[model samples]
Target: MKKLFLSTITIFILIACSSAPTKKDEIKTVKVNAAIGEIEGLIEEDVYLFKGIPFAQPPVGELRWKAPRKLAPVSETIKAFSHKSKCTQPKENEFILDRGVTEGGEDCLYLNIFVPKGNVDISKNNYPIMFWIHGGSNIWGTGNSYDFSKLAESQKVVVITINYRLGPMGWFSSSHLRNTSEGDDRSSNFGHLDIIAALEWVQENGNSFGGDPTNVTIFGESAGGHNVLVLLATKKARGLFHKAISQSGYVSSFSEQFASEESELSSAKVFQDDIRFLTEDQQIADYLRDMPIKEVFQRYKQADESHLYSISPISIRDDIVIPKEGIYKALEDVDPSVVVVAGTNKDELNLWYLRSKYFYQTALNLGRNLKRSEENLKSWIKYRSNIWRFTGAEEPLRRMSKSNQNLYSFRFDWDEEASTILGDYPLFLGAAHGLEIPFISGDYSLVPAYARPLVFPNESKEGREYLSNLMMQYWANIAKYGDPNTFVQDHRWNKFRIQNQNYLRLDSPEYIQMVNDPVDADEMLKTLESDSTLELKERCLIGWIAEMNFVEEMRGDPPFDFCSEYTSIDLLKLRRLTEGRD
Candidate 1:
């Protein structure tokens, strides 16, 4: 569930001030701080955790859709014990964030923290700090989902989780919102600004909580992972995070026109052009900002459930924040000094293709409502664009995916059918998208089987232990040394290399493989990405060409069944070159 609160005020001192460095905080439950204003905290052994503590003032009323400002200082300590209520949204919204109307208020700009118990000399101790940004397509998810107390207690590091606005509340970008200050082009990405503010708060106050602000690792999954990239490239977020980890996050592929005016105007234009009819054909620009929030969302939802098409803007690259729209530029163009660990799951686009309601509709050939079907497919294909996502920039994207290859190239294959098929008819989830979360967070009970074994009996006991150890090892490795490798790694860590397309296969008992790379992953992707791109069938043709020699028996044979004669062996080699640094 997505949450929206950011700060809480409550006072609880689990580890007495007089105590020197000890193991755990004496108290077992959460402790809200009076200094930071009552934020909630929980004790999982020796660590005290505060969940949903606000770092900035909520963006509502006058603050609605504005860049988040520093949190207002209160004279009294606020209670920070429970999960801050989230904003209003539907249950189906899985951008990974949710704001239940009843859950939170406009004042929800909080962050969560975990402090090790009975520790003194905390500053010089240099305990690594991990700041987690949750992924939910930028519109769903809060920071409280994963409890970081164990990580804090075991590693003796400070771990923090934070909330940023979502949907129109968070990522509605454009050059629309005027800066109360002069000549500010940051109008479009206020939500991103909110994240930056939270980081700033950490830098300033981490020491007070006995954390080393200097050694910070900013990481997240999906949209949160994407934000890490955004922060990586943005001049604003530079140095705020010394290291970064992006899991299952890819570059936002939007045309120049789409990236021009903050993303919201694109939505506005789409609304004016088509969505007006639903609301008696109101002008998109005139009505969107003024209409009741429910009506505005209702009108947009009615027209199309997919937020990308017609109106919703994806990633905006103005001079201020995002210097470039894609991660390719960030890696190739930015300084290598900015260390990163970027990896994708085994089936990167599986969720885009499989989870799409459009695919289900197409598969069943159900003559559902045309508008609804069209809207659903529009959204589906947009993410899973045969050209944009797969063919058009496939090779380049793959190259980008493998750009930081020297770093750990991990593929999380933890399978859970129940969670993936939350509401789907076909319940076969083979290492689906976002499956890495439970593994990384060690949340095995993610599915009905694990959470409630009666319905999902397959949440085996072995699986739980495997997931728990895997997540802890991976996180601890990165948090300890910016490197995702451990001294006791069960499997040997592999780097992205040209000759061997090796990725650390993270399954029960570690294994590795030097199999064939996606031969047409780039060329087909490039072709499909062109303004005048190839059709899906055309892509299949090109894909067939690339895979000509990409057979399992002949792993390195560039001339396998999928590749056409017109395709060159050099292209495959080029792909290898791009995938591997040397």
Candidate 2:
């Protein structure tokens, strides 16, 4: 019976594959001339889909740690149906798509395009372009992970997703590497450079796919959102994207000295002095570059002392891509013409608190020791979420709007009909990190199979669909015009200002509405400051994670001062709780 069931499933899959539509009569293959060659893409679900189009030469061999080079132009025609390998990343245990399903390796600098088919001629229609940057703490995730067909077809826009380098390979920096190089090659944030290259590709080739290169809106979630902020402030990224949206993006600062122990843990110092530094700086650079990608990844993983958070793949304020004062001060220098949409989810930290082994063990320890694990965890999640709002959304908007830039802020609070069969879904996950992705994409599969019902429960399908449609329209409208309220007639998304500080509060049942000072910034701060149950050490940990990246400019008014009352042993045990060895 088991064999029969397996045979039946295989046959069903074969039948489904065979019956699926292919480009045949109605625009089977859409041909367009790109930078390198004339590319042929297929039409799927009324949209032209192009996958695995390389924007930069593969960063392999001696080119490993160096900046990405532009691909030379070619006249040859190439098929862009299949996606290329995802960049080398740490293994995921939850959903490992088969090797046959998608290829992944170091040679993975590529972009995918999805354009809705229009009855009008390609040259006649200028659809707004939405460029998506996936977030995985800059260590994992790929462009292929998202399916933009729903977003493209429904919104009648062109959506593009690109993969940049990850982990040490993407952002590794060293004194030796910098001194040995000249020009922009001396810059450390290779991942940011890769994103610039991709955007450059879009500027050159996006119009071929019925996209308006002049009106492109760059948007991303988490690290991707963080990248958007960097691009907004980056002089090199000027004129690349007209509008930006940073979903749950934070302005974490990086240390100035790339290799010194005084600096925060960086990819360049992943080995922590285990690797020898030879006589010649060039020799050291070669040695580090020539090391196997897997070995490099493993070394960085072992040396990861950032506790539960992922902060290694950081953009350094190397006075090149990033300004010396970091992203906040960089915002002051940002072109006032460039607008922004920035916000965070209601329970942003719950995702980390619920899934991280470190947090879980810490909760267990609290349960065993103080019998206050659950409450502490809840308090920590709420405190961290509040901090994220202040740092990631409110503070950034406050600074950016000061420069006379038309900015908008939002707080995603849509959590409805969540399933709790596996655990307390409402309390544990809520509307956490990356939860908004599925809603924006209208792809519930992005959530884990077991968690799909909870993320988009059947009971809340009406409200969920309404919220998704509203988001799609708002985002597409923002891309088309500078304002999200352009097409949204009924809903008025007020502009963020220094005094009013108005923001859109997104909810499921109520859809979206404009309000002022919805998040009590002062009250939230007081809650953290006055909470007696949370020790100073725990408060410090929450603040550090909330800060995301530590830049030199923030050394004066740091989040939390050193709590001399706590001993090293007390912190060591806490560290063990975070490391999951408790």
Candidate 3:
């Protein structure tokens, strides 16, 4: 009689559970077993957010300047609702700091995950994952700075953003820090290693969060895009990701001094000398490893702005993570099956020129009158953008296609009704380098202070919303399947081929179409040369520097080999002027 009563109670419980409502079941809270512990995340409306989830052991103390280590599993639960401290980076502009944000810290190897409501069944359903890497020239910026809720909810996908080491902390190479006793004692590019570790964590934990680990897509813009290429070329990252999208990605090579070998003036050497001068010569590595965060930050800040670009942050071709011949040279070795979408904006360089206080000062010097300065700046901006698209986008895509890899190219030309602080925004900042980021992520708050008011005004709300939705769909669609055409029913985003040189000209609400034989760089340069008001040599060097993110590529061979007249001094002057120290 007692056994019969227990069986009846069990049956009643099962029946109640089966009959419960399932549609949009209110998920006030959610839980998932991730890397370190069982994470308790919050469910607000239709989105479930898990922020500040640690993926690796803190690279502090002895681990400083070393590869990340696996984080041991814990029995405790983690309340992952708030963002952790960002990785150590320089203080941002005043507008950014006014938000009461502190500078980055060393213990910042966390990631944020966003999952839509209906796709939270790890036991059965499989949702696509988009891993994001933030871009700030690899010097500054954090993954937590972005909000991926809209993109995740609108398209049933799992979105992730991560924080990796930055600046000297990320890419510094030191002879003392190299593992001399090991089989291979190469150092530098710890940031890249951190990214690899993060992806590995995803591979292990993605399924627990209702994501298809096998269908992961890595996408980034600018520096982040560059990293995507690095991962693409990396042998260890071969099976880690299936697809990649590099927005306004530039190809660059690092020097032996920055990566493999030591130089008299390398970042490592300079810091070592400073430490010895302050403390002592013995145990340089120990002293550096144990140095106070304040002192290290001070030394890092003392580095010359010019040297930071020209001498530092170049990844060493250790033949382990990155090859000896740089990414472009190493691309032939990457798996041909990996689908790639690479492209740049119509006016990538305009953002730099418009944002530069130095450029504004130069315009004042040249104009002697406000209107004249603005005109010359506009003309110069257009000239620079054209050359940028040619060398950075069109040429690289054409060259990469020779490797027989599946690739597509695009040029974002949507600069409709963008009038900001500079006045006449359309002509000045049309489809700038980072403009596509806000559109794709549906987070307009990431838009810069100056451009925010003008580009996203109350009147143009409809257009902005339309463009954001469309771009997000394209991006999410690509992440879901190998092709973006599977999502958009109205228009087919043609696969970029060397034969036709086809590309999608992304505009919104009315004008997004495919075109061939875009702008000609040589012709644009000729026009700039004829303009007696403009300084031809400075214009050429400025355009080149702008294309390469203010860093002049001095390794291997000269970038603009066609332009023979510009001297090293001319390039130096351009750099100083751009930095506003001149």
All candidates: CA RMSD (Å): 11.7, 6.7, 11.6
Better of 2 and 3 by TM-score: 2
Best by TM-score: 2
- Which stretch of 10 consecutive residues in model 3 shows the poorest summed lDDT? 1-10
Which prediction has more favorable lDDT, 1 or 2? 2
The alpha-carbon lDDT assigned to residue 80 of candidate 1 equals 51
Q: Please, what is the TM-score per model?
A: 0.68, 0.85, 0.83
Better of 1 and 3 by TM-score: 3
Sort the candidates on lDDT, descending order. Answer: 2, 3, 1
lDDT of 1 by residue, 369-466 (tens): 22234333332233232322222222323444434443445555544433332332122233445656655554443432322342123554565456
Please estimate how well model 1 matches the true structure, expressed as its whole-model Cα lDDT. 0.51
Residues 1-582 of candidate 3 have per-residue lDDT tens digits of 000000111110000101222457654668887656688887867688888889989999878878888898889998786788788876634322111122669999999988887745542557898999887667667787677888888888889999998777777666666643132325477888899999999999887777889999998877788788788877878899988888876666575555434533365655755555554323766777898666676665454442523445456666667777767667656677778887778877655554455445324211211234666666666666665565445655665677745777788887775453345657655676677877787866554444356666677688778878887888888888888888476667877678877778787767777878655545654555566556666556654554453232433212444446876666666655553334
Off by over 4 Å in 3: 1-27, 93-102, 119-123, 179-185, 258-265, 275-282, 305-311, 357-375, 390-392, 418-422, 448-453, 518-533, 543-571, 578-582
* Alpha-carbon local distance difference test for all models: 0.51, 0.70, 0.67
Query: Residue 69 CA error for candidate 1 (Å)?
Result: 0.8
Query: Whose lDDT is greatest here?
Result: 2
